[model samples]
Structure formats: structure tokens, C-alpha cells
Target: MERKCNNLPFLLLMQTSKVIHNQIKEEMAKNKLGITEFSV
Candidate 1:
């Protein structure tokens, strides 16, 4: 239980980042921009 609690924040952060990343990808696609282009 202690170990799982310690890792919970990291796991949540990863999941949140993934969600944000997918949203960014979708927005970029709608704008007809590739990931490389969008990053710049």
C-alpha cells in the first residue's frame, strides 16, 4: 500500500500527459499541421 501510494502521482501525471498529447495531436491534424511543424 505504501509503495502504490508513492507511485500514484507519477502514474496520474503520465495519464494526464497522454491525454493532453492526444488532444494536441488532434488539434494539429485539424489545422493540417504535422507534429514536426507544430513543435516549431
Candidate 2:
């Protein structure tokens, strides 16, 4: 039980990190799309 409790925060942090990375990727993709559209 104690081990599980200790790991909870680590798991949460990993999930949050993944979410942030995904958001950055999405934003970058959107920027690229905008640039492509502008060029065309």
C-alpha cells in the first residue's frame, strides 16, 4: 500500500508531462498548417 502511494505522484507527473508534450505538438502542427496556407 505504501509503495502504491509513493508511485501515485510519479504516475501523475508522467501523465501531466505527456499531456503538455501533446499540446506543444498540436500547437506546432497548427502553426505549420497556417504557414503552409499562407504560402499557398
Candidate 3:
């Protein structure tokens, strides 16, 4: 018997993460802030 892996959730999570990262990057750029500084 073989087990199948489900990739949809992981792919969706990565996609969502990338979108959020880009949005944060853009916002930080607009504010002239570093990621570490922004996080603090």
C-alpha cells in the first residue's frame, strides 16, 4: 500500500505567506523602516 501526500494546504500557505511578505515589504519601504525595526 502506498500513501499519498496532500500538497494543496502547503502550497496555499506558501502563497499566502508570500503575499503577506510582499505587502509588508511595500509598507516598510513606504515607511522607510527595516523589518527588524518594524517588528519591534
Candidate 4:
């Protein structure tokens, strides 16, 4: 139980970042931007 609890937040953070990453990719695609262009 202790190990599972410790990993819970890490898993949640990864999932949240995945969602945000997908959103950014979609936005970049809509704007016809490359990764480097989007980062600026």
C-alpha cells in the first residue's frame, strides 16, 4: 500500500502531462507550426 500510494502522484502527473502535450500538438497542427516554432 505504501508503494502504491507513493507512485500515485507520479502516475497522475504523467497522465496530466500527456493530456497537455496532446492539446499542444493539436493547437500546433491547427496553426501549421513546427515544434520549434511552437516553442518560441
Query: Across residues 1-40, which tens digit of lDDT does each residue of candidate 1 receive?
Result: 3545468888999999999999998999899998789989
Residue 14: error of model 3 in Å? 0.3
Candidate 3 lDDT tens digits, 1-40: 9966589898789889999999999999999999789999
Question: Which regions of candidate 1 are displaced past 4 Å?
Answer: 1-6
TM-score-better candidate, 1 vs 3: 3
* After superposition, candidate 2 runs with Cα above 4 Å error: 1-6, 33-40
lDDT of each: 0.89, 0.76, 0.92, 0.90
TM-scores, all candidates, are 0.72, 0.64, 0.74, 0.77
Clash tally for model 2: 0
**Highest-TM-score candidate:** 4
Best by lDDT: 3
- Model 4 Cα lDDT, one tens digit per residue, 1-40: 3544468888999999999999999999999999899879
Off by over 4 Å in 4: 1-6
Error of 3 at 32 (Å): 0.8
Q: Which is superior by lDDT, 1 or 3?
A: 3
Candidate 1 has what TM-score?
A: 0.72
RMSD of each: 3.9, 7.2, 4.9, 4.0
